[model samples]
Target: DIYAYGSTFRGGEVGVVIVNSGSSAHEISIGGLAVAVKAMGWLVTSNETSSSDPLSARGVMWNGQSSPQSFPLLSLGAYSASLSDDGVLIELPPYSAAGLVVYF
Candidate 1:
């Protein structure tokens, strides 16, 4: 139901990406990040949260493969849902310590 707009299976470079899990807690990649969300049957914009970072950011997720606690990445498209740490960061995070990053 929720996946990268372009192609979930081959999310190569359609301007959209997925938030899958990884080995470490901080697994997702946040560089050149962007997101799209559909909530309450309504649409959201990634204007404020959307950033064209050349350095690369990261997100933190407790549930990526299982559970419904994947709050950081609520959907996949071009909107933003309270963007968090995606993994692959130069510095460590000070948040909850439970981050599931997806390198896109």
Candidate 2:
């Protein structure tokens, strides 16, 4: 199962949070925007495909970075979303979460 939540920010930016609970990948598209100029966000997922492995819990990576304490100011990599004809296209991996910001 996949869930998506979205809200508009103060500066006309749209923030979206997506969660995939099932053990399958999905490609989703979001619409109802004026014109999306940019899309960026962070993804959290484990190295293993399934979370059944106890050791996989320690393999969680945020935006491709394994260590969260390594950065002094909590910087997220420039993870981008693709702009589709319908709206914004995002890939949702199994048992993963993503937070995105869409600017118009």
Candidate 3:
């Protein structure tokens, strides 16, 4: 099961998601709602890990993918205008938890 919680402000939104299952990865979509995302942090239950490594998580795409071609995990921040209609896709590892802060 996937659990999510957050709030929206005049400038942006913030929230957290919990991935209960441990088999497949999950993706979240935020489309046509914002212009960019400032940052994100992740904590994997199985890995017992959580980090916001800027070097490794330069940014994220709307398609649930990360930028810099490789930095997509542990951190998130993307400032662009080519987001997909599918929205801002947030990749969630198995049995993990994440927090997101999006900007407009």
Candidate 4:
């Protein structure tokens, strides 16, 4: 199952949260905007969805990078894409969550 939540902020910025709870991947298209120029976001997920071990369950990655252990914060890799005429297309992996901001 896939769930999506979206909210429009000031200055024509739209924030979205997509959650994929099932074991299959899903591709979603978002449209109906006046004009969408770009989309950027981050994804959080673990290696496995079924693992119950404390370490495995607690381990999470931001945009496919492991958590940092020292200072000099880890650089979050942004997911950027140019919107098509139809809209912005997003792919969600199983048991993952994505936070995105769409700019107009």
Scored by TM-score, the top model is: 4
Q: Write the per-residue lDDT of candidate 2 for residues 44-93, one digit (tens) a residue.
A: 87766555852357766777776477655257666886565577777887
| lDDT score for candidate 4 against the true structure | 0.78
Q: How many backbone clashes does candidate 1 have?
A: 20
- Candidate 3: 10-residue stretch with minimal lDDT: 47-56
lDDT of 1 by residue, 24-103 (tens): 22323434444422111112222222335311334322222222344554553222234334413321222212222232
lDDT values of the candidates?
A: 0.29, 0.77, 0.50, 0.78
Model 3 C-alpha lDDT per residue in residues 36-92, reported as the tens digit of each score:
534444444442223333223333333244233454433444323334445566677
Q: What is the TM-score of each candidate against the true structure?
A: 0.17, 0.77, 0.46, 0.80
lDDT of 4 by residue, 1-104 (tens): 88989899989799999998777788988886547788888887776556753234766767887754553534655889888778777788778889889888
Off by over 4 Å in 1: 1-23, 34-80, 83-104
* Candidate 2 ranges with C-alpha deviation above 4 Å: 50-56, 69-76, 81-84
TM-score of candidate 4 on Cα atoms, chains taken together? 0.80
Better candidate number, 1 or 2, judged by TM-score = 2
Cα error, residue 71 of model 1, in Å, equals 20
Q: Global CA lDDT of candidate 1, please?
A: 0.29
Clashes of 2: 0
Model 1 scores a TM of 0.17
TM-score of 2: 0.77
